[model samples]
Target: MNKQPGTSGLIFNEPLLWDKSREGRCAVSLPKPDVERADLEKDLIGDAPELPQLSELDVVRHYTRLSQWNFGVDSGMYPLGSCTMKYNPKTNEVQAARQGFAGAHPFAGEEFSQGALKLMYNLEQYLAKLTGFDAVTLQPAAGAHGELAGMLMIHAYHAKMGKQRSKIIIPDTAHGTNPASASLCGYDSINIKSGDNGILEPLAVAAVMDEETAGIMVTNPNTLGLFESNIKEIADIVHSKGGLVYGDGANMNAIMGIVKPGEIGVDVLHFNLHKTFSTPHGGGGPGSGPVAVGKTLEPFLPVPRIVKELDSYKLVTDFSDTMGRLHTFYGHFGVMIRAYAYILSMGGKGLTDASKLAVLNANYVKESLKGTLNLPYDYPCMHECVFNDEFQKEYHITTMDMAKRLLDYGFHPPTVYFPLVVDSAFMVEPTETESKEDIDQFISAVKAIAKEAQENPEKLKKAPHKTKVTRLDEVAAARKPCLRG
Candidate 1:
């Protein structure tokens, strides 16, 4: 089937590279082998590899066209709540691609990697100061990885105190990774329900805190986009019971310089640098989620922390009660470089402005859609807003249908059916990076969709008429995934 361009002339139905290859076609020229004749491994080697051959232009156009087909934060506004899909700065990209950082070997000696080491060291310090933590670890590779590292450290801290606490208090508003991290550390996740106002209440947490409890895993400005204002009292309750609090810093984008988790009584927290620090996200790989802690959990940090020693910087693996290494190298160095560059570029006041603007933008969008949709929480949201399929459900409309219809309007859908406490949830997070004009356009599109949902219900049911492919049978696709032809 012939497919129309989605954006920037992304031609579809392009032939496979191998399908265009002729037997003798070649894209690159190679010199004759310099090895001795006796070096040929005829006795052990198998058949020669079957490689595709094409002209250099053909190779370039093929990948470039494919990249055009893919949507990214740069391509348009992505309002995915709890994900913080902000525009990654071009300046940060330039910094990350610097020859000094991009070309460094992970296995090279510390003397040869002083600049990279120094960057990492300074980054650790910046994160520590920003989050109000005593120290920070850039070991964990991503947000979930950081969660696992933090949970294990929590387990270790309790174990060192001669207690076998095994239950972790996870609120319903948490990202799914929270309980998974707790379970991975051999702790049972005791799910707690948030209050009717969509924020975690101090009384609800007090009812669950006990001797066997490890701690609470709470996300500030939670999935509902409402801040847990009673965090300090909640933390005190957990601490009074000899437990620790683990803050999931996924929503750190909402509270950058405005609030620090460490000062709010969190013993341990992990920062999603990929989200808050303008690094590339959405792809499965290349993310950084550095964990920071107060003095209590500092001893259990990952091994080989980059430290400064007089004139030179070096790695020190001297922690006696460390959680060991989380990655082979010092996490994703390129990602860290992007994050560090973001910090240096933004500085302290700039970051605070980012948080303020993020909150302002979200409230602006929320006000634009309030009462038109189901405002379940109905309060000021920090960096995102949550709505349910209230009025739309009367017409048999669902969050999924609304999401699919958004594609036709040239807007990516907000996260749907998430933070399960909200019924038929639809969450939107307009990060600080979005301009007021772009936000107004998004608000207009969503309003139009709501109007269309009431007037012509069938349109949403069969949405995305302009894309390369129409609505997909997601259930069938999931149940019978085609791994290969």
Candidate 2:
């Protein structure tokens, strides 16, 4: 495909709908008013809202076009590392949208919503057993929310023991959410740098442990895609210092059935169902992040936990020291339904096989791109692989340039300059759902970009010429957000 050069001004086929509005032109005629209510106070009322006046078809076509511009797992391979943008099975969607599940109100009585409650209860048990944790709470809306809930549980656990721990330790390569969650929970985050090969050493953690340390937040097979082989030692060190171990289970897809965080001595962990389980992720979610805890931290779980009785299930709202409620209702129940469907559909062996295949896919991509890119770590990876821009630096090309050029080839780029540990990191996660052909296509695109970077650096710098939108002024967009049309 020949790529277009330079920018074009915003162009649209239809005139601005606002320009076509007449004083009394209405999209639809309303029925006669049955009753009139008293108007609000003048101060409470704003001037007439400036809404675009468009016919129904105009609005539909505009949104349809906008939706087409979106890139998703359904569209193609999304190699976003740690974000596991895998294909969400359509069957899960069918189950989620079933009237018996989707149409139920959150405020419905427990007795009336037995099926929904049972699904939630069974899901908690399944996840707890799968993760080797004593209890699970599905109150967190997303992975980050789950992290905050886990930290709060840790905080409450220490407070109950009459201990005053004020710091939470996280590896430098940990997700951005780890520190953010700690800060939100009134705990200071102590960042420990990982070793040169992207693994956090046990001794580094042990050296930093003090009486004030709450726990260590570890992301095994961490952001750099290297497993933390010293996890047992690290967990023991934190435990010896009276600090708990918090596992950020964002990368849980890599080790789903192979290992359980609790078995490795992690006291608390958050599961990103949207990432690991086949849940749709977009539009800031509707994501589920159920937190599982060991026996020690079970009492501090969030309120309204589902309890299965003799023949039925019930919701428990009262607790001695619960973390209150992390969400308005049991966090995103429909999302939980989808995840539950995924879990049951996959079964035990299927889950393990999925993990193995995911690891295999990632390794395949890693090995394929090794010579064309700079692999930061030498050892085998889990579900993702990390590469740096050292190979392209000689040509004055950057990871961003390569990423932008990928759009021209009809592929979304891997996450770039992340993990913050590497200089120009390009972390790729070719999920298990992608076929060998899809992987090869991505590999070919990346290889072509690498070649172009050396032969025609300027083309890479002015890349993504085929995308619907060209390069954006990201800094300006952040500073002056234009949210409205």
Candidate 3:
């Protein structure tokens, strides 16, 4: 068999840019200023800033080597559960970089920015249709932002009906941020536990859902990667109590064309464009989380909403019931452009196929590694699977140990110790982007590590021997962080 792709090769150790600085070196050559330098106020121009000085080649090599040290979806399989770090088509980036879209000013009048407006309008329409929602606002900046928007709108809906509820029902299986979003909108979170099958039970929801509760926040194909089959019943219960259902579309990659959240009793849904559609994500974003709502919640969507007025689109904020502006401007325009390009490029059929493949890939990983790892939820997963370290307990190994060992085999580790429900959780999600061969290699690497856990358990404790940096004392680092270099 071929060696794993993550095998260490000749790695270059690059020092900090400041460490390589030389007093007289410079990366660029410029002609003497033809115009006189303008004087700046002493306060405006602080003491000449400290900076690194280096030649052009020095700067180039420094960054080039640094890039090699980093791992991304482009580097190898990034099986991060709930984080769809798939390989987005490069064409999406190309479209986003076009001068007209890239250079359009945020403050440009609608007439001058017709193309941008039209794109936004059409993107909203597309998302609305895909999720089976009546209206969509591309204003929330991220998944959590969208959650807050949905909760605020729900609160507003209740207020308009002459009663503002004080609590929202959140299942433990929902996204971790669901409670935080509800709390941000002044609604106390009524936390409910999912049933033994890793999904919310209608009866459990019925037990606490009342007129005092605003609504329920659910993540379809939740963090555990299991679909809540009783969602329709749960939604009916919430609706009967004059409450709405908020769906977290973070895992929309699993059911894009298969099931629309709107048709499933969801009153409001938010799409993580960076996850569901293809867009750059991570590193604190540049993320887009457009919120979609059914007709009941449409009036409270964030404004100024983009509307088409006979061939020309305009931004209108006249709705008195709007949740008000969430972002300074339209959510991340670059992310929107990239997402729009992705949707256009991948028609409905293509997207459905992507979801199917994503689900298939995750199940493949789950079945392949179940023998080597402990799959806490041994049912069919949607686009990810949850595993625990129970099987490795006898070997005196742990999930973190196995995760660190993956680095030595040249593969990025799956998400470890998450979903919080499972002890020593190791969540893996091989998105549709990965091929069977690549996934098999990842499985092999994991199995090899498991074997090592039994025979050479001590070594697993000090794993990732090939990386530039070794295992860190994460606890100490978190407690006594080094604020300065």
Taking all chains together, each candidate's TM-score versus the true structure is 0.94, 0.91, 0.97
Model 1 residue runs over 4 Å out of place are 1-11, 29-45
Clashes of each: 0, 0, 1
lDDT (Cα, tens digit) per residue for candidate 3, span 1-485: 47787656788988788999999999999999999999888798878889999999999999899889889988888888889989999999999999999999988888799999999999999999999999999999889999899998998899899999999988888888999998898988898988888999889999999989888999998999999999999999999999999999999999999999999899999989988888866778878889999999999998899988887888999999987899997889899999899999999999999999999999999999999899888999999999999999998899999999999988888998889889899999999999999999999999999899889999999998988889999999999999753
The C-alpha RMSD of each candidate to the native structure, in angstroms, is: 3.3, 3.7, 1.7
lDDT, each prediction: 0.87, 0.87, 0.91
lDDT of 1 by residue, 1-485 (tens): 12211333344655788787777767788888797556558668877777888887888888887776677788888999889899988999999899999899987899799999999999999999999999999989999999999999998899889987979999999988888899999999898898988888899899989999999998887888999999999999999999999998888888899898899899999989889998878878679989999999999999988878897999999989997888887888898999888998888999999999999999998998896778898899999999978999888888888888777767788999887888888999999999888888777777777888899999878987767778999999999997742
lDDT per residue, candidate 2, 1-485, as tens digits?
23321234343444456765555545666798889967777678867688766666666766676666678888888898878989989999999999998799977888789998888888999999999999999889999999999999998999998976889998988989999999988889898999877798888998899999998999877998878988988999999989999999888988999998899889999989998998887679879899999999999999988887898988887899887888887888888888899999999999999999999999999999999999978789999998988999999999998888888777778898897888889999998899888888888888988999888998789887876667778899999999764
Q: Show model 3 residue runs off by greater than 4 Å.
A: 31-47, 483-485
Model 1 TM-score, all chains together:
0.94
- Candidate 2: residue 171 Cα off by (Å): 0.8
For model 2, what is the C-alpha lDDT against the true structure? 0.87
Find the candidate with the highest TM-score and give its number. Answer: 3
Q: Worst lDDT window (10 residues) for model 2?
A: 1-10
Q: For model 3, where is the 10-residue window of minimal lDDT? A: 1-10
